[model samples]
Target chain A: AQSVTQLDSQVPVFEEAPVELRCNYSSSVSVYLFWYVQYPNQGLQLLLKYLSGSTLVKGINGFEAEFNKSQTSFHLRKPSVHISDTAEYFCAVQGSNYKLTFGKGTLLTVNP
Target chain B: GAGVSQSPSNKVTEKGKDVELRCDPISGHTALYWYRQSLGQGLEFLIYFQGNSAPDKSGLPSDRFSAERTGGSVSTLTIQRTQQEDSAVYLCASSLGGPSGGYTFGSGTRLTVV
Candidate 1:
């Protein structure tokens, strides 16, 4: 079985500032990682995914994540954020059975 | 028609009542999944249907939770004698059939047990 852990429950940052949402996972086998974002009262939208290849994966809305195999981490990062970037972000891991395990999520608040 | 669709968008049911949530997967999608998101919590997998294979019910919390997919296109999640803990947003998603293909999620049905 696979599991995901999001270190921070909430992150507050100023507009134009950078932010990083930490995520870690546990699995006995290789896994695929993904980041999804959800705005208020909306469904989740894929931010980016790390299936293989380059460790650094870029996603929509200027978001990117780096997959660190040794640390078992796939942290989402943004160079500069806007107020609209505020949302709840989820980290998910897909194991061999193709089941996705998700972390509790991190609430990002970008303020002006 | 183009994306996964779930309804009714919001459902309020009394305790001990039975509720059914519907999901219509995208045309030609071979994999469908059900997940529950509690308030301030992440998504919890409930079940998944792939092709004609047996549906994966391992993630179901208890016998009170059951689901079925019809004709490989639509799915329904039924909760019998719902409890307060059953209150959550039930999300439905569909994919081309693998982790690499990713998934398209519906807006979800908010089930509120009173």
Candidate 2:
């Protein structure tokens, strides 16, 4: 079975500061990685995804994640964040069966 | 039509009662999934339906949880004798039916069991 681990339950950062949300997965075979953001009371929206090719994948809202095959990690990063960026982020992995295994989400609180 | 639609944005029920949640996936989507999100917890896979294949119930937490997708377009998740632990947001998603496809999720139905 596949699983995702999000190291941080919550991350606090000031506006205009950079942020990184850590994620690790356990899978025996190749997998697709994704980062999704959810605003209060809203559905999840794709921030970025690493399907194939480049290890560095850019996504919406100036967010990016690197798929490290060696470490089995897909960490999401943003050079700078705004108060509006405050939301819950989830890291998910898709195995060969197309089922997505999600991490326990990290709440990003961007303070003004 | 444009996005996955779930009914009864919020539902409140008493213990021992049965509740049903509905999901209308995007038109033409062959794959639909149901997931449960407890407070302060990650999304938990409940059930999956792909085309005409037998649904995957491996992730269901208990026998009290049951789900069905009809015509390969709509799905319903029913909880029998709901318990306090059953209170959570139930999310529905759909995709093009492949390992490489990204899913579009609904706002979710919040079920509160009293």
Candidate 3:
């Protein structure tokens, strides 16, 4: 069984400031990691994923995440954020088969 | 190209009524998935459809929740005797059936059970 933990429930940052959303997972077997963003009333959009062969993954909107196997973490980062970047970010783990376990999301609130 | 599409963008139903939500995956995609998102919560996997095989129904909350895919393209999620707890944004996504391929999502159907 796999489970994801998002350490923060909400994060508020000023526009143009750097931010990191923390995510950690627990799994006994090798797993695939993903980050998804959801705007209000919209479905989840894939921000990035780590399948294999890369520890650092870059995604759309200048977002990136690092997959740290030893620490069981896949943390998302962005050097500068925009007000449009405010959304709910989710961390997901896909273990054995295609079933994905998602963490309680972290809401990013970027203020101008 | 058109992205994954879901019909009836919003639904308001009385308690104990049955509701059906529809999803149309992108062309040539073989894997389809259904998920639910409640207020201020993460997605909860509802079911999956891959080709002609039986769907992975493990995520359905109860017997009232059911889904079916036709012609390997369009899928429908039906909730029988809907309860207040069934109200949520039901999202649908499709992928290329690869371990690394990311999914394309639809706008989702916001079902409100009154």
Candidate 4:
């Protein structure tokens, strides 16, 4: 079985400052990693995914995440954050069986 | 549909009242999934329907929870004898399936069992 662990439950950052939300996973086989963001009362939107290319994957709204095979980590990073970027972020891992397991999610609150 | 559509954006039901949530996937999409999101929790996989394959019911938390996708387009999740613990946001998502694209999610139906 595959599982994800989001190290932080909430992260507060000032506008225009950098932020990183940590995520880690555990699986015996190869996996595909994904990041999703959900605004209040809204559905989740895919931020980025790491399939089989470069470790660095970029996605919508100036967000990016790096896949680390050895560390079993895929942490999301934003060079500069905006107030609108505040949302709940989830990290997921799809195993060979095609079951997507998600972490507990990290709430990003960007303050002015 | 242009995007995944879930009806009854919010529902409040008394305990023991059964409720059915609907989900309409984008046109031509083959895979649909159901998930539950409780307060302060992440997405919990509930069920999955992929093409003509048998649905994966491994994630259903209990026998009271069940889902069905008819005509390969619309899905209905039914929670019988609903309990307070069943109160949460039920989300639906669809994808092309098979490692091709990211899933498109609906706004979800926030269910409150009082």
Cα lDDT tens digits for candidate 2, A16-57: 999999999999888999999999999889898999999999
Question: For each candidate, what's the DockQ?
Answer: 0.77, 0.79, 0.71, 0.74
Model 3 interface CAPRI class: medium
Worst 10 residues of 3 chain A by lDDT: A93-102
| lDDT of residue A12 for candidate 4 | 98
Sort by DockQ, best first: what order?
Answer: 2, 1, 4, 3
Q: Predictions ranked by lDDT, top down?
A: 1, 2, 4, 3
Model 3, A2-102: lDDT tens per residue?
A: 99999999999999999999999999999999999989878889999999987999999999999999999999999999999999999999986777789
- TM-score per model (chain B): 0.97, 0.97, 0.96, 0.98
Q: Pick the candidate with the highest DockQ.
A: 2
* Candidate 1 chain A weakest ten by summed lDDT: A93-102
Restricting to chain A, the TM-score for each candidate equals 0.99, 0.99, 0.99, 0.98
Candidate 4: lDDT of B104?
88
Pairs that collide in candidate 2 are none
Interface RMSD of 1: 1.0
TM-score of 1: 0.98
- Regions of model 3 farther than 4 Å from truth: none
Q: Model 2: how far is A27 from its true place, Å?
A: 0.4
Model 4: colliding residue pairs: none
